[model samples]
Target: MRELTHVDENGVKMVEVGHKGEVFRKAIAKGRIHLRPETIELIRAGKTKKGNVIAAAQIAGILAVKKTPELIPLCHPILLTGVDLTFEFGEDYIEATCEVRAVYKTGVEMEALTGVSVALLTIWDMVKAVEKDESGQYPVTRIENIHVVEKVKAQVQ
Candidate 1:
């Protein structure tokens, strides 16, 4: 096992990447939000009260990628070259995939993961009215499987 980079004798500290060479970094993350079939139909039909669910979620994902540093402590602010968010619908769920690309000294996996999380949350928020049960609880609605699916770092040429 490797030592934790965020900690040292001085206690927790941000990992310094200034000495590292810049590289082309990319990360892809995915997550899913489970909802009622009726809720999925509403989203598919563009009848959600909060406007377009997929559109709002896509924008939210991109914004989340840009704001990852502010949301996650100890994360370094990075200039992103690209961000992409996509959605695939199942019978009772929506799967979100977020991809982030940058040329920097460190990885962008956190940003990609953050993007997918927020996107899933946005979808849930947009459709919560239909997903809630009579007791005003989300009986079957849930978010899960948030993870970084891929990461690549190549030397900048």
Candidate 2:
């Protein structure tokens, strides 16, 4: 198996990317939050008590991408060129897709992943009041299938 870059015989260390040339990098991640049909309707109808769920989640996702390095240990702070977060609706779910772009020595897959996760979590938070059951538990609400769908990098020049 390949050796781990973050850990070595000495101890955990951030990977040195300064020696590598800058490259155009992009990453896409997607995730979904399952909710009650009624909760979905409330969100669609703009009747949620917390306000516009999609807009709030989109902003949260982009912010999450920019703050990824601060949140995740060992991540290099990257200069992101662009970030886009979009959402789609299903019968009982909302799907979030996050794309991050950068010109840097390292990839932005973690940033994309972070964006999607926070977006979904924001949705969950906004609609939790309606999603919880009599026991105050989220029986049918869940965040699922959070993952990086793509990662690409090429020479910047």
Candidate 3:
């Protein structure tokens, strides 16, 4: 197995990227949130009490990508070139895909993953009223399959 990057003789430390050459990097991440069929319909119809669910989630995902360094320790504050969040609806789930692009020394995989997570959570926030059971707890609502779908770094093409 490869060794961890954030470690040195002094123990644990943030990886220094100053010596690394800058490169164009792009990362795509995805996740899904399962909800009641009713909730899905409400979101698709733009009838959720919280307003447009997809719009809100998209905004949340973009903001999360910008704030990733603050949330995850050791992450460099990269200047992102672009951030896009897309959503797909299934019969009972909403799938979020976050694509982040940057020209920096390090990859943006974590930032993309963070964006997906925030977007899915935002959807949960918008639909909780309809997903909660009589016991005031969710019986079937869940967020799953969070993962990095792709990560690429190379010279400008």
Candidate 4:
């Protein structure tokens, strides 16, 4: 069995903590989530009726990076050196990539992940009017493939 770290008062496992040193000082996470076919079409046609989905999502992603500390507990509030969010339009999906850079002791993987999640949420929100099915269900909402792509420790001269 894998070692567990978080324990309750009764010594029951509540969470699992991995190796301490294994955590990267600087890390990058790349994620690719899909949007529904109808939503994609609406985005391509610029006919969401709410606003520009890509632009709104892009802005939301950037803002999410800046507010990562507030959203995630235990995340150090570091000044991000850079944040880049790009959306690749596909026939049946949308690929979102968020790159976040910070010169801090802890990595910014959470920030990048949060950025992508918020961006996708924003897109869903903006296009809900068109994406909703006859029964008012959001059948096309989904998120997938969040992984680290790069990590580099800051140099101390």
Candidate 5:
């Protein structure tokens, strides 16, 4: 059986990648935020009183990427070379992808994941006013399908 990387016979511990060769590592993660049609229209017209949802979510994604090490236990503090976030809107959902690139021994999958999750959350927050009904309950708003879409490692050029 494959043993857990974050644990040993002695219990939980951070994975050591210090001795590994440095390389260009990139990761892409994606997630979706679901909302009512009315909320989507508010975002499309940039009418949300809270402010520009896309812009705020983009900034939140960037910040989340840079702070991944601090947010997730056992994540290596790698200097990321690039972080990009894009949002695509559907009839009732918004898709967010965060791509993180770094030249380090460890991959940035966690960072990319963190970025996408935070971005989706920011969208949820910005549209909360409309997502609720008179009953003050969220019937449609949800964040889901957060996963790593890709991971690549190569020698730094």
Candidate 6:
């Protein structure tokens, strides 16, 4: 069995292995990604022609978070306590951050990541129509910095 690290009586490092699983617990996770320039411009200009870019993306993110289990196999279905999604526009790219909280036996990190990815894809779908010019050129190029920010386990007395 693999050994796991834990703090000892004097706050010293200790190795333990084969710990038993606990029932009914909760966990948290986070993620983010960068957006391309043409994608940003399409969002800013409201030229999607389908609808408001940000609004649609936000809605898609929320929906994705809720339906994460359905989309991804091996992920447990969880009742999310809360989900917050935000977009930060930068000079060269856009930052998408998704935070999800749930009171289940497993963490919601995958859900949060899925939400961000869907949001970005939604943006791409909406803008791809307008991004293609006469020469089939597009400005948006990449997405980066997708990761978790923090995670915590609640203790019961």
Instruction: Estimate the lDDT of model 6.
Output: 0.67
Better of 5 and 6 by lDDT: 5
lDDT for 106 in candidate 1 is 96
Models 1 onward score TM values of 0.98, 0.98, 0.97, 0.77, 0.97, 0.70
Q: Write the per-residue lDDT of candidate 3 for residues 21-128, one digit (tens) a residue.
A: 999999999999999998999999889888999999999999999999999988999999999999999999999999999999999999999999999999898889
* Candidate 6 regions with alpha-carbon error over 4 angstroms: 1-39, 45-47, 133-139
- The number of clashing residue pairs in model 4 is 0
- Alpha-carbon local distance difference test for all models: 0.95, 0.95, 0.94, 0.75, 0.94, 0.67
Clash tally, candidates in order:
0, 0, 0, 0, 0, 0
Report residue 13 deviation for candidate 4 (angstroms): 18
| Residue ranges of candidate 1 with Cα displaced over 4 Å | none
Misplaced by over 4 Å in model 4 are 1-27, 154-157
Deviation in Å, model 1, residue 125 alpha carbon: 0.8
Encode model 1's per-residue lDDT on 17-135: one tens digit a residue.
Answer: 99999999999999999998889999999999999999999999999999999999999999999999999999999999999999999999999999999999999888888888889
lDDT of 4: 0.75
Candidate 6 residue 67 C-alpha distance from true site, Å: 1.4
Candidate 6 lDDT for residue 99: 79
Worst 10 residues of 6 by lDDT: 22-31
Across residues 1-157, which tens digit of lDDT does each residue of candidate 5 receive?
9878998999889999979999999999999999998888889999999999999999999999999889988888999899999999999999999999989999999999999999999999898988998999998989999999999999988
Off by over 4 Å in 5: none
Query: Could you tell me which residue pairs clash in candidate 2?
Result: none
Worst 10 residues of 3 by lDDT: 3-12
Q: How good is model 1 by TM-score?
A: 0.98
lDDT of each residue in 37-155, candidate 2, tens digit only: 99999999999999999999999999999999999999999999999999999989999999999999999999999999999999999999999989999999999999999999988
